[model samples]
Target chain A: MPGTRARRSDAEVVAAVRAAVVEELAEVGLGRLTMDGIGQRAGIAKTSLYRRWDSPQAILLDALQAGFPQEQPTPAPTDDLRSDLIEALRLMIAWLTTPVARATGAILAERARYPELAEAVYTQVFEPKGGRFTGTVLRHYAAAGRIDPDRLTPVVLDIGEALVLKYTLDSGELPDEQTLADIVDQAVLPAADRPH
Target chain B: MPGTRARRSDAEVVAAVRAAVVEELAEVGLGRLTMDGIGQRAGIAKTSLYRRWDSPQAILLDALQAGFPQEQPTPAPTDDLRSDLIEALRLMIAWLTTPVARATGAILAERARYPELAEAVYTQVFEPKGGRFTGTVLRHYAAAGRIDPDRLTPVVLDIGEALVLKYTLDSGELPDEQTLADIVDQAVLPAADRPH
Candidate 1:
């Protein structure tokens, strides 16, 4: 029983540290993130933090990557590209309501003030997670020969997520299912080679 | 000479107060905005602010609408829809680098906390300034019979600004000339009825 408690507590400490980095970044911003602050917020010793992570930024990056969602595009006899794009956007909308999403927004909103942190987020978190929302699905379709490779430009791939983001930024609300369907049918499908 | 100075000082005071509202929103955020903070920042009397505006949100809305740029879709013999769409995005990029833009970001970013303020930004600033970037151009071309009116759906109209905002959020830099053109050619034109 004592040994089980020791192993479980180790996992708990790691989870606490991950959550603390996000909360810390939100409170102090990327510029003022400190190891001590993270440790205090997680209720761990500062030395314990240094043992695992070299700095506060590293821990934050680890947290972001750990929490970042991956879009799953299932291969089927009847794979629907339109439905897939909308589904990817739905994943994005769901992510928007999370603590990690808020942390990502915090880092990005002040990106002009803290360039390297933002860069690290891209290189470490988003890039490894499949570039951007809807990107994975597009790539999946392209690989399966369902879509023309030429149509999968960066701008085309970004249409669904981008419009959903703009909608949220303008309205302060997550897009509804109808909005997602509209995005897929009107903007995304046409650019993804499904012309009109 | 004294009369001219009095008239100039009055204009100067209004300008200072307008600038102060944006700066105060940046530092104190929307919820913390107050007459005392704005007056102290602008170095003016609180009574002077209330003379023209009823609340801090009122001043923010007024300042935003004052600074908001209108999209100008010029008519030429050729009247290139592609170039006009690109130009509209260029205007949006230019606006993205301003103090007012950052103030707008602060409001929209915290819109989940202040829904009314976000809605006010739309009704007061953006809708009056041609809905969204690329919106006026699409409408202009549609009205001129260069584009099909039915193609001007909300999702299609949003493709350009949404992509630019997503690009900036991802890369922490404004989209380059090539990137903007890609958005037009790959995304905007296709949705606007170009149909490659």
Candidate 2:
């Protein structure tokens, strides 16, 4: 029972630290995020936090990844490219509109003031997930002869996510079915499809 | 001499207040933006600011518009829809990458926490400008038979701005000429033109 309690308390401390990082990011933004503030907010010992993470950025990285768990693999495409794109975008929309994404957006919003952090996020957080997802889906379409090689660039791959991101950021809502469908049929498919 | 001095002082106050608003929004974001903070930062009386604008939101709207002045009209489409679309998208990139846009993006990044403010920005600022530009250009293309009537919808019209917005928000840079051209040629123009 003593051993179980010790392990349980440690697990709670981890969760608290993760939540505090996200909460602090939302409150003060990346420019002002600090280890002292995070420790105070999480009610954890500063030394213990320092023992685990090297910097506030490191804590933030773990918090974000923890908030959006990577245990679930991105869904693979089936036969239909259109359906696959729709499904992929739907999952993207779900993730981008989550509490974690919104909190991360708050920090990223200050990118002009904190370019290093922004770049870290791009390289460490966003690009890895978004890029991998885009690459996987685009390659699937390309392999099936549905998309041209020239059309497989980053900008084209970003079309669906970009549109959905804008709409979600603006409206604070994942777009309705009609809007998502239009993005897939009108924008994504056409951009990726081989031009006649 | 007295009249001239009065006008000059008023102009300075306006400039200071506007600059302060932009700076505050950049530093603390919309959630923490307050008149007291802005007044102290701008070196103006809080009462003076309150007299001109009803709320911090009003100050922000005025500041954003001031920072990204709207003197130049969005260019109308010429006979060549492709060239016209290119020109329009170029202007959008310019505006979307301005400091005002970046500050606005910072506030918008917290939309989940401040939905009412987000809606105000959408209705009062973004939609008004983005909608007008989209409508004016799309109508021109549609009337000239360059674009299909059905393609005159909002989503299709928004593809260029949406793409540019995402790129600007992500990289804090206006997309390069090639990226803009691709959106026009590969995405916007093709989407608008008669479907095969």
* TM-score, candidate 2, chain B alone: 0.79
The interface RMSD values of the models, given in order, are 1.4, 1.9
Span of 10 residues, lowest total lDDT, candidate 2 chain A: A69-78
Candidate 2, which CAPRI tier?
Answer: acceptable
Candidate 1 chain B worst ten-residue window by lDDT: B1-10
- Give the winner by DockQ: 1
Candidate 1 residue A59 Cα shift, in angstroms, is 2.2
Residue B104 in candidate 1, Cα distance off native in Å: 1.7
Position A84, candidate 1: lDDT? 80
Flag clash pairs in model 1.
none
For model 2 the local lDDT of residue B100 reads 78
Tens digit of per-residue lDDT, candidate 2, span B27-101 = 887778899989989887799898899888888888776654232223443266666677777766676657777
First chain of candidate 2, TM-score: 0.80
* Tens digits of lDDT, candidate 2, A119-148: 877777766554533456677657767677
